[model samples]
Target: MNDADNRPVADHPFPRFSDQELARRRRAVHDLMEEAGVGHLLVYGSDRSGSAVPWLSEWPVTREAALVITPNGDDHLLIQHYNHLPNARRVARGVEVDWAGPSTMSRVAQLLPAAADQGIGVIGPLRARDHQLLSESVGELVYLDAQYTRLRLVKSDEEIERLREAARFSDLSVAAIIDQLEPGMTERELAAIVEGSYLAEGATNHIHYFATTPMASPDTCVPAQFQSTRRIEVGDILFCEISAAYWGYAGQILRTFIIGADPTPLFVELHDVADDAYDAILSVIRPGVHARDLVNASAVIEERGFTTYDDLVHGYGGGYLPPVLGSSSRPNLPVPDLHLEQGMALVVQPNVITPDQRAGVQTGQLVVVTGSGADSLHNIDRGLGRIG
Candidate 1:
């Protein structure tokens, strides 16, 4: 079967990882299992969402999939949906691929020796029923989601290169929108432009959210999680949060634009504050910097009588990893007691919103932590975009 990219599903080439990278991931998984003292590891996924399955086995989960790893033997990958078997076999590296049968969890249980009593380490989003079945079958089930996240926190050189490609594709998508934005366009049309920018290039969508409201009487603060049918007017302000993916890796970027006119004073103020917060947050990101420090830098928003409706900054690539932070005025979650490490990717977005949550501007993009500081992976212009 061939996908939209004109690449055969069984032998697609754009997303392959090197054998060395795959082996490095395997070693990390084994080390995690040893530290947790588990005999077997089960990585589960549904609807193509789990990060670990792809990181370890190179198989993007489709429908449902599970990977079973043993310390001394070859790893086994069980893919659900009979039709997906051929592609899973071809794409996945260094793992034995097989059909998962009617019940994926039952197949997993049968793989565990009947006489074995060692605990099993579990990762990914297993359903409650499946959790119960695994618990009954094993002596103990060790939840290793956190450890798995830790394994993904630092990107290898190969992973960073993939992220850079994703970021470039993302920039193209944003530029497409800015170039074609018209006063009478609907939010749906805006989304079409975003996907159109990269779909022919074999990229996929992670997320693309929009908010359109008149600058004179702004009613929406943050970008809506879903697109709208509202017709954009001459003086409307449109802001979007978009991520275009290459394989499973994606780059997230947010920007605001004024349609057919210059921004009003209120809109100008919101974007200026957002730009400052974006700069402040990025200036403090480096190896060994605490998560709290990033939030502290965004205090300019609150100090200037503005606040944020979305996370000021967050870990990105491989999943929403950790250290998700918000401004002091609006705490998304308790600041994690984590420090930055080199090669960690983060989205330093500052969705500076009014105190009443009626207006805002979006600014930021994906960046990688380096020896000196954070480096942006995107080349999109960082300004309040204006369209006519």
Candidate 2:
């Protein structure tokens, strides 16, 4: 485990968690099971979305996969799609891998203990049909999705290192777009540039959203959740929210760019307010800081008569974990009564948009909470981006 930790990440054809790190995760999950009085834990995933499958077995769930954890440390991992078996076996650590066959839930039900004292604790996004199957097979089915999310809030040392690598890849993606953006290029081309930067480096796209509009007569504020075919034009503002992942760990960054011209006065003001709000929020991001404190710091944006379209701050590096907060001007979710911890990572974006929702700017990156303050994992320049 020590040797693997010390070796360069590029040396491994596929990234892996060290044995020690895997053991720690198993122990933590076992503790959770004990607390919940569940004899077994079934971590399920489909279409590669659930964070728990990869968090436990290091096999990022592809078509479908489920990790059944028992107290005896003899865990069984079932993978769907016969072709995905080889890779799952190669990458999954500390588990017995098998084919999940025609019915994934049936395979899971068969593997679970016939009788558990507190029933079966399940995590991940289970389809209603599968949920019913599991419930029928086992008398009680306890949903522990929220509890599993809480378990991922504070990262471990190895996890933090992986997050730093993810952040570097995210920075590279954003920088590639900034350097190659041209007036004639389409947003689809921009998306290609972002992925082209890091795909070869074994990083996958978590998300790359773009919003391009004429700065003179703006039409959009926040970056669209999906890319568009609209071509970039001179005097257009292009803002993006991008995250590139190394394995399942990912880094998020938001940046706004002006194509083929300098920013106008209004754009400058909007970006300045976003930058100030980013700084203000970061200033109070030490361990033990309440979630509301970060929101309060962002009051600068509203004071400057601007609003935000996206979340002001959100936990990152492990499934958008907790303390998802929005500015006072626009509260996305109830301000979570959560406090920052030393190893917690967050993206402090202040997507300051105009009150009329016609214009906005993106400016922020992923940062980890330290004992004294927050430390940015990304090295990209934090100034307003300009391109030709």
Best by lDDT: 2
Model 1 lDDT per residue over 1-388, tens place:
2122434434656477766787798889999998998889999889988988988877888999899999787678999899999888767777789999999998999888641466799999999999898778765688999999998888999999999999999999889987887777788898899999999999998899898999999999999878878899999998989999998799888889998888999899889988988898888889999999999998889888998888888898899979898889999799999999999999999998888999888999999999999989999899898888
Q: Report the alpha-carbon TM-score of model 2 versus the true structure.
A: 0.96
- Model 2 stretches astray by more than 4 angstroms: 1-11
> Which candidate comes out best when scored by TM-score?
2
Q: lDDT score of model 2?
A: 0.88
TM-score of each: 0.95, 0.96
Check candidate 2 and list the clashing pairs: none
**Candidates' lDDT values, in order?**
0.87, 0.88
